[model samples]
Target chain A: MGQKGSKVQITENDRAILQLKRSRDEIHKFTRRTDLLISSERLKLKEMIKENPTKCKSDPRVRFLLKRIHYQDHLLQQALEQLINLENLVSTLEFKLVETQFIKGLERGNQILKKLNKEFENVDELMDDVQMQIAYQEEVDEVLAHSIVGVNDFETEIDKELDQMEREINPQQQIEMPSVDKLPDLKQRPIASSERKEQGKKEGTEAPVLA
Target chain B: MSNQSELPPIYSFPPLYTRQPNGLIRRQQINSWIEIILQYCISQKCWRMTAEGMPVGEPDVTKQSIFNNSSIQRVVPQVFVDEIWSQMCEEGKALGVQDGKRDSSQFYILWRNLDSWASLILQWFESSGSLNQVITIYELSQGDGTADWEFHGMPEALVAHCLKPLCQRNRATLIKDERGIAVATKVV
Candidate 1:
């Protein structure tokens, strides 16, 4: 349900209305697919938790292969800006510029705008980054939450795929994840466990927008 | 990295899901909306969306699952229609959205951006070589055998809006139809 409370009446030049309708529609599709992706990612993370019990080392494949390493948010913001800029450009065209040779310039600019618009056509790539981050984070959180019952499955091969996905969001870097059973020996397992729990909570919220 | 504020104002608007207001912009928005569907609807291509929720007054089923009372309490609550409409409207995209319906005059631009569309029309005009020839405004509006070009489905008001510029260069003229519709003749 939308804001049924407000008596706000949406009225404007027909074309502007059309543009809003359109962007929403496209975004709706984007969000819809995003929902499905996030769902599957949730399933994967849940399964990993169920399979692993004690702090045996998470499958490097699982931990390192997570999506959403970094810059994906940048792209979403970019694409969104691109469309908005296009919208503003169009609105300005409607409002200003009466015939001149400049129409040709406008035409050329239109091509650029069109090309930018095209980038939005397939936004699933953006979703992939967001989902990966969430999925990996979920696994991390769940692992920390349960406090080691046994084998945590993290695979390095899957890490390869995740590396590609993460590259789009963040730079590709090889990270070493100790086996679930191999907790870092910096301190006692129990003390380290408590500290990790705190760290996990902090990282959970700070998930960077991959762009 | 783009500042979140630097992005289109559409981002913050909660009611982007609401419908449009009037004129050429509205229809263009609708056509764009139609275009946007090509990406989603992988299953059977759900092209025609009415903005009304799924049949039985439920929100998108997936959204329903995610928004629980705890999450609802944490973040501000937004209903599907209201949120979509409000976001777009607040960001200045919405117009004429009412209780359960959007104004027929209002449309969402989903697919091609309007400026590109203007260029598209201009290109069609150039390619067709009918620039100077008289064209009943109706041909450009939604009618029989139209929609051949992206320009089809354009509102007469929008056609006139575009022509206003063309006419300044003496490249086009907007005369009257017997029925009071605009008849434009763009000179190549």
Candidate 2:
């Protein structure tokens, strides 16, 4: 008999919860529809009043219109209040439901701890694997360091060769005079005959020896 | 006049109420104002405007003047308004008072010139078989059949002026009673 009574109590609680959910949905829909209607109507009324304030106020219907707006606002406020209360009721009910789930969760706490310990063991194995990979990376780094030092020495040798080449090129550039025959035709035309004769003799003496 | 809602969006612009200082901008502003006035007059069937480009009242609609954008609290100066009127006169879009009056504050806005209005009246007469049928000047201007006509409510003097072109063309006969009142006309 007590079991039957408890079953009835549970069903009553579920029915109350269902009623609350339905009321909440109704309130939500009502609020949405009313909000849209109220805002648009408010805008239109405001514009009408603004367009002709005296006329709007003097009209006998304005009082009734204002009253209707006030009533709508009151309804909206009441609906919002009901909505909040229903939401609170639902949250409290959910928390009460979670309380039982929490107690059930405690029953399996030791098994959860055992699973966590197994996960820690896996983490230790992963750590060891990571250490092995790190040691391999250190060996690779040492080989790379040795190769890099060799490459650095090779680079210095090439730089030294380039320096010697530049030194040889500088003196040869100083000794080398552009040949009159190879000079542009515009430059040759501007030269006097005496200067050309001097240039020819200098070229004949220096050119064959350099060759 | 018809409702003021037919005004262009720029009609509410405050700058249009002030004549631009630059010559080219002023000219363009004048042209825009002229276009607005022409459109407004034509749409409302307004025949006359004050020098300030406001519609002359037959049956008044509103106190709001076209030259003033009251919402913006700006008004085109009367001098500038008169300049626009003179330009309209130059374009033959408006007729000035003829008697060299000092205060010629009123102008007739001619959406169609007096001659065209005259021809239209003549055509109405022809189509309606009222040709050679003498009718009082009042009947011609405000008769039942002419209610839907554009020349309806036209001043008797202006109607006579319009009919002068028709008379010269021998399409109309002006009849004056013994009292020198132009009592009626017969379109031939």
Worst 10 residues of 2 chain A by lDDT: A1-10
Best by TM-score: 2
Each candidate's fnat, listed in order, reads: 0.00, 0.00
Candidate 2 lDDT for residue B152 = 86
Which segments of candidate 2 are over 4 A away from where they belong?
A: A1-211, B1-3, B97-103, B176-181
TM-score of each candidate structure, all chains considered together? 0.25, 0.43
lDDT of 2 by residue, A1-211 (tens): 1122211112344445555655676687688778877887778778878878878978666666677788888999999999889879876886776687798898799789998888787787799999999999999999999999999999999999999999987755556767888666774565777799899999999989989
* Docking class of predicted structure 1: incorrect
For model 2 the local lDDT of residue A46 reads 82
Q: What local distance difference test score does each model get? A: 0.47, 0.73
Error of 1 at A178 (Å): 99
